[model samples]
Target: MLGQERSRSFTATAILFLLPAVAFYVVYMLLPIPMSFYYSLFKWDGISPTKVYSGLSNWDEMLHDTIFWGALRNNIVLVVLSILIQLPIGLILGVLLTSRIRFVKLFKTVYFIPMLLSSVAIGLLWKYIYDPTFGLLNSFLRLIGLQHLTTGWLGDPATALFSVIGTICWQYIPFYMILFMAAIVGIPDELYEAAKIDGASDLGCFRHVTLPLLRGTISMASILSLVGSLKYFDLIYVMTEGGPNHSTELMATYMYKKAFHSFEMGYGSAVAVAMFAISLIAAVAVMGVTQYDARAL
Candidate 1:
């Protein structure tokens, strides 16, 4: 009886200690979520008290909204591109740098410089680099006598989407590269030694040993990349603001445009909710698969 009373007393004390954090999460995260849902049911310009609760009208519009569809498609493209290009490329760089190379630490710092900067700065810097009129890319193309390749990257509809993807890749690849390097360092040297003793080639040893051991880390990095891409806004906003016929519009940017620019607060809230739902689902799916794989092992 005494032990039970003490345990209950300790539990109450722990709850008291956790109260501030719990309150913070509720106020900052949880409350806004439901409030956003409520806002999604109304029709308001965000400044007036004349909100009309139109039931599912806002959600209905979002369902058939072409811009919303475009935003969703762009987000999907970003996720696919980040995983397909950024992660593999970063892993390759990590593998090479972890080898018997010179100035690996220097190279790492240089590579990660862009990622360390503000997204706005990175986007603006890349925009200038990709500028057609006086940009380095155009200058290089002209110098190589490939003047025909010079075109306004963000201005043209054809290349705008891809240009944004490239910018994101440049800023993100170094992050994954560092992650992969850490994971590679954590691997046991005995595995590689045993593989070499068994007459395994370098490529074969990497395929059998390095990759298998780095599985957990790669999965974690991939999941993070995917989630980040899904909620992406700042860089795209800084560079293009979904310009050139809204080619680079992502869900997050789209939601912001709808709420503030278009003054469709309710509809924008619906978009935000949809975004939250999509990210939540993707995170859960990735985490669930990773957990299952671990349990199987």
Candidate 2:
């Protein structure tokens, strides 16, 4: 009886400690989801006195919206490019930084500068770099007699999305590099020593030992890249506002434009709900695949 009473007391204390965080999560995270869905079923301007019930019309409209499809395609491209470009480059930098190279500290500081800047600042800086008239990129092209190659980088539909994507990758690569660096640091030196003693070359040791050990970190990074790409906004919005014929449109940017800019709150809510669903599905799929691969190994 005494032990049962003590256990109850401990459980009560634990609940007391967790109450604030649980309350915050429910209020900020869980509540917003259902509210978004509710708003999605109405045609309200977000400031009006009355909300007209639109039922499933918003969802139906989304299904037929070509722009939404384009934005989703862009999001997918971002996800693929982010994983393909960021992970390998970050891994290389991580390996380089962790190795006994000269001026390692300086190199690290230089590489991490992009991650330190705000998205808006980086966007503005790169916008000038891509400017058609007297921009750094065009000036360099002319200096090298490659004037034909110089054009409005962010203004061209063919290049706008790719240009923005490149900037995004540059800004984020350092973050993944740091993540990889930490994971590499946690690896036991004994494993590499044993591989070396077994006549393994640096490349061979990395392929056999390092790659296998860093699988979990790689999987986690891939998931992070995936989700982040899906919900990406700010920088792209600042750079292009999904312009040049909406070539750089992303789901988040489109949603913001619909809700706040265009004042189509209901449609924006629908887009938001779609984004949430897609992100949740993608994250679940990635986690499931990673778990399956782990179990298979």
Name the candidate that leads on lDDT. 2
* lDDT by residue for model 1 (144-210), tens: 9999989999889889989999999999999999899989988889999999999999999889999
TM-score of each: 0.93, 0.92
How would you encode candidate 2's per-residue C-alpha lDDT over 162-255 as one tens digit per residue? 9999999999999999999999999999999999999999999889998899898999999999999999999999999998898999999999
Q: Which stretches of model 2 miss by more than 4 angstroms?
A: 1-19
Instruction: List residue ranges in candidate 1 displaced over 4 A.
Output: 1-16, 295-297
Position 44, candidate 2: lDDT: 91
| Least accurate 10 contiguous residues by lDDT in model 2 | 1-10
Looking at candidate 2, what is the lDDT of residue 75?
95
Among all windows of 10 consecutive residues in model 1, the one with the lowest summed lDDT is: 107-116
